[model samples]
Target chain A: MQGRTRNIYLIPYMLWIVLFVVAPIALIMYYSMFNIDGAWSLENYRRFFTPVYLSMTLRSFWYAILITGFALLIAYPTAYLLTKTEHKQLWLMLIILPSWINLLLKVYAFIGILGFYGPINSFLRIIGIGSRQILFTGFSFIFVAVYIFIPYMILPVFNALEELNPSLVDAARDLGASPWATFRRVIFPLTVSGVKAGCRAVFIPALSLFMITRLIAGNRVITLGTAIEQHFLVTQDWGMGSTIAVFLIIAMGLTMIMTENGKLVK
Target chain B: MKKVMQMFITVVIAALGLMYLTFVLNSQQGYSGGNTLTVYNWGDYIDPELITKFQQETGIKIIYQTFDSNEAMLTKIAQGGTSFDVAIPSDYAISKMKEQGLLIPLDHCKIPNLKYIDPRFLDLPFDENNEYSAPYFWGTLGIIYNPEILEGMEFTSWNDLWDERLRNEILLYDSAREVIGMGLNSLHYSLNDTDIDHLMEAKRKLDALSPNIKAIVGDEVKMLLANEEAAIGVVWSGDASEIIGANDKLDYVIPDEGTNIWFDNIVIPAGAKNVEGAHLFINFMLDPENAAQNTEYVGYSTPNMKALEYLPEEITGDVRFYPGSDITDKFELYENLGKKMTAYYNELFLEFKMHRK
Candidate 1:
């Protein structure tokens, strides 16, 4: 009777997954097989393997890596420091508050902050460095992305640190391990799951970022997401868009596998 | 276990009921009553008061929707999900829709105000004999510059934009067609040139002008130019008018080398449920006084020649926005470059953008 009730409870979740997740993915896969003309063909897949797409994929991966690397670098220390603070939860909330604001609003804010007559340029001008073209560059794109993603990176790592028992660190220190060695040998490995989760959270979304590439990068940077959007919306070629999406999905799966905790640690 | 089961069942019932309610509400929203007309247009293209006046005058409810791009509007209509009574799409998009049979033929007998429109706008290549579309507004893609900043430099031809003095002082519109068209026009090639070599040469030439290219941007092009962030911007004539109005120091010019002249037209989609209502709205908009009002508010060139009488002498007299046929004759309307060629142009443009970095 208990088993039957548990199965009954699972029904709604299964339905939700099938309808929203599984079905859409299946539809995309089905669409990927067809060409723009609606004929059944592997033309889109063939095109995906070309140098144009391959190079774009590489560029997108490179940008995603840069964004994730910067985000993790900033977030890890912030998260670690927060764990030592008296009002850590409040600080964490403060970090998350900016994210609650609409993403487009935040992006537009960066536009003003990075504009020629914006504060940064004015500061530079006063300091004798002179104003420079700061907005719509790779640097601005990565900066805004890192800023937007820092909170996501921090939350999981913060949670991991919070969940950590202090005695484990004390035990390591008592054994004559240096602070770096204790962290490297013990605390980090234990919290490795959180780091993986945080990276997964930031990296996956970073790969498919389109709007930032447009508004912040001024279309100078084209990620895989932008190409997918261009194909689907501008060209009205859903097949090509779906084919790229399929590859993105595969890439995401590979990332998950590579970041899987037991496999990486072991 | 029994209590938990009871609570779970109650929650499921409540969720199902909420979903059903939302579904019904959504379906009701799309329900076309006899007196309702749904209009899909570019954001802020029409004055709100005009829609209110239109609704009051005809006793017809108006459901107005706006799309940011022609492609986005086309995709929504092409999907056959929503039944928009009227849509305002640009020249090339009209051709694409006409070819796809997504557009409904306009009934001229109902829209008597069509007589007010200039004959020059009629019987064009996109919709010959005004079959599927009617001219709403038309403008040329041109250069808008701060003459104060540019000083002795005159931007007469497209080549002048490449002057070394203008380095990092030019903003190009972030549209593939206009930017590519500028390059093609400089070389005296057709903007609709299908030859891959000509298209490639255009990209190559544009690449060399990167020193002058400060940034490629969209609607914000107007804001940046008006604030003197850039000395010159390649923009639409209508946008130039708005920018020039914002900052009197700014001036607009249609290059002597020729440029793309685009038209935004109102057309009924194939799935329109209230066809008659759509006609009434189109006719109402085309009325000389209404067209003049829209022209004043939208800051776009009105195609209604009769409406010119109602407009201010300063507006109607401006040769930049309303040029004589001698200059307009050199302008080309963007034709529907077939799917493959359109994609090729987009790809080449993307490559040019990527090359900038």
Candidate 2:
């Protein structure tokens, strides 16, 4: 009877996975086999392997790496520092509050904040640095992406840090290990799962961001996501779009495997 | 074993139930011989009051939907799911739809207000004899610049955009055809030139002007230009008028090398369920007073010549928005480049953008 009840409970979740996840991926793979005119062909796959697409894939990977690296660099320290604070939970909530606002609204705000006449420019002029074009640059793109993703990065690391037992650090210190040595050897290893989790959370989405590239990067940057959008919407080439998406899914699976906790921990 | 069999039967029954529910809901939303008209148009393209007035005058419920791009609109209608009664697509899109047999022929007898439209807009190459579409609004691509920021500099032709003084001061519209067309026009070639060598030359010409180019953007070009963030912006004549309206210091001009004159027309999809209601809506919009009101609110050039009497002189008399034949005679409409060529243009444009970084 218990087994039957468990089976009944699993049915809805299995249905959701089949309907939303598995089915769509299968459709994309099926579509990827066709050419623009709906003829069965390998043209899309051949086109994807060309230099133009290869470079874009490389560029997209590079951007995703930079964004993930920056998010981790900022978030790890912030999360670590928050654990040492008195109102840690409140501070974490405050950090997460901005994310609750609509993403497009936040991006638009950055456009103004980074504009020629924005506060940052005014400050620069006051300090004799003078105004410069801050928006639409690669620097601005990475900056805005990291800012948006920092909360996701921080949450996972924060939870990992909170779950950590203090006696482990004390045991290291008690054994004559220096603070740096203790962290490198003890605390970090235990929290490696959280760091992997944060990276996974940030990197995959960064690979496929389209709107930020359009509004913040000024079309100067084209990620795999933007190319997919262009092909699917502007050119109405579903086959090519699906081909890019198939590669993206494969890349994501590889990222997950690389970040898997059990394998890395062992 | 009996328990496992029972579980499998339950799962199959649940799946069937879900599928049946979906089918029922979909059918409910499908066209069912109602006095309802589904209008799919660009967002904020029509005045809200006009829709209300139309609904009141005809007693037919209006189900208005908006799409941001022509391709998106075409995809939805082509999918053959929802039956959109009326759609407003641009010139090239109309041609593409007609070729695909996705549009229905317009019944002239039902749309008497078509007589009020300027004769020049009729019998166009895209919809010869107004078979599949009717002119709604038309505009030219031009330059909008802040005179103060430009100082004594002037943009008389497309070549002026490349002047060294405008370094990082020009905002190019983030559209493939229009920007590439500017390059072609500057080189005295047709905007629709499909020759590979000419296109390569145009791309090369555009590459040299990259230093002067600021951010290539979309609708935000209006806000950026109005705020004087850039000295010059290449935009549609309607957008130029809106920018000028926001900042009187700004001025608009049509480059002497000629430019693309585009049109948006009301077209009924082939799968329309309320074809008569769609005709009624189109005719109501084309009426002189209604068209004038729409033009004043939407700030695009009205194709209804008779509507000029109802419009303010400031709007109708402005040659920038309503240029004479002397200027318009040189303008060209974008031809429906086939799928391969269209994709090629997009690829070249993408290469040009990637070249910027």
Candidate 3:
């Protein structure tokens, strides 16, 4: 296969990305630079310099980090445990079965689980502890976000763990390394790629959580996605909405660059 | 959703419209997609059986779509090239569409059933003389509260929402206008007032009320209230009716400080292909029985005077559905403040959302 003939297969997928992704992004760029009347301006971006709006953009980044960190903490162990399980495929299936449910439905279910009269609160009442407001707090926001995206973290880490060389761990243990030291020295160092990949998978979606933020997080979590929605859908300010969307896209790109840099460091 | 570049969708829709036009004209006579009407409306706003009946009577196929909000509907039609014959948009949106040239002047002469609509809703600020739109459903914002939770503290004023005694027990409407408008109403300022000091006053009230609110929410407020997770909430009349039905302990009240009255109106977009079909559809929807059916199904108050006779006594007699003139006389309909004021209000709202304690 000559270079041109071999590259023919890439054409279809390249066209798909260009049409669906690149062109739409180009349009957003166009919109971010103009108003509804088609006047060329940076007025939309200028509006975000206010402290309140600026904080929302920053808070969204903080939330993405929080969700990614939490997902890693929980999913790393869950995935590692899955690696030790007898029916690995069946266990993985159970892990992914919830994700297959509708995202909105899942968020609604979280509301039921975390509400004042919910099972958690009922259990608390039974234990002689008073019922507390749990559903609309910042804690519940991250919990649901972590709940929704943890599987993304788990799958990649699981694959990476499954690919671990057994000889390396045995060699570390034979050299008088304790269980923790053997795992840290041999297993952890090699799975950096998977952790990085999982962060990539989890971070971007978590950054743009609009619906779940409203349902689970309540008014407490005003993210960049919420700001964009207010402008575009509620206020009918498309230019402003596009500006926030452009900011979001750039923020995600920067994250990707940072993740790639981490890979380069090793 | 990030890829939904609303600004550039106009061009794409124009191109699609051209292709659609070609397809429509190329087919055989009488079978050439000539008798089809396209409608865009709020989800569950109308009685579906009426649509079926309209199609059966007129022999016109109906293609219907539903939008969740006025802005969403406006964005779709604003993209242009849509052949949507009819759309139901809120009042402020009608003003915006009229200013944007997105709507055509409705032919009142063709719509004889417009006579059946109440005089109160006609010749309003959004559409003077009802030129571009007809009233569909109108409702007011009110406090829906559980009496047992509030310990029989009769709630009547906007300040009641800010009551510190109700800390973390209040559920505020997630809407920028309605939430902030309630504050404006508390201070006796117009909800559409553009004065910086007045808006700042409302902001201060909201900032003060911040500690008391459990959440700022939309439709989810109903379920939360029904579950007794929230003691009180700001909700529209229709939602209040349904939720009150579910939980008998909950009751709806329009505060003495006054609140917003909104209208979901039916209009024909400028580029509609079947203007006659649009008029016919509007007329059919306005038929007293059809309008009554819609009110019953959607649980929103109808603006059609003739329709009131057909509605059940329990629904028509519900004070929330049709509050007394003394209370309703003070209700303010939302005005279209255009771009600059809307931006300011939106900014104020974002600041309120960011308010801590």
lDDT by residue (B107-209, candidate 2, tens digit) is 9999999999999889999999999899999999998888897886787899999898888888887788998999999999999999999999999999998
Pairs that clash in candidate 2: none
User: Judged by lDDT, which candidate is best?
Assistant: 2
- In order, the interface RMSDs are 2.4, 2.9, 5.6
Q: Which run of 10 residues does model 3 chain B get worst, by summed lDDT?
A: B25-34
User: What is the per-residue lDDT of model 1 for residues B215-290, given as tens digits with 9 covering 90 to 100?
Assistant: 7888888888887877899999988988988998998999998999999999999999999999999999999999
For model 3, the superposed segments whose C-alpha errors exceed 4 Å read A1-4, A7-9, A35-39, A43-47, A262-266, B1-34, B52-61, B80-82
Q: Which pairs, if any, clash in model 3?
A: B123-B129
Could you estimate the TM-score for every candidate?
0.91, 0.91, 0.89
List candidate 2 stretches off by more than 4 Å.
Answer: A1-5, A261-266, B1-35
Model 1 chain A lDDT-worst window of ten = A257-266
Question: Candidate 3, residues B244-304: lDDT per residue as tens digits?
Answer: 8789899999888888988888999988988888999998898888999888888888999
Query: CAPRI verdict on model 1?
Result: acceptable
Worst 10 residues of 1 chain B by lDDT: B26-35
DockQ preference between candidates 1 and 2, better one: 1
TM-score of 3: 0.89
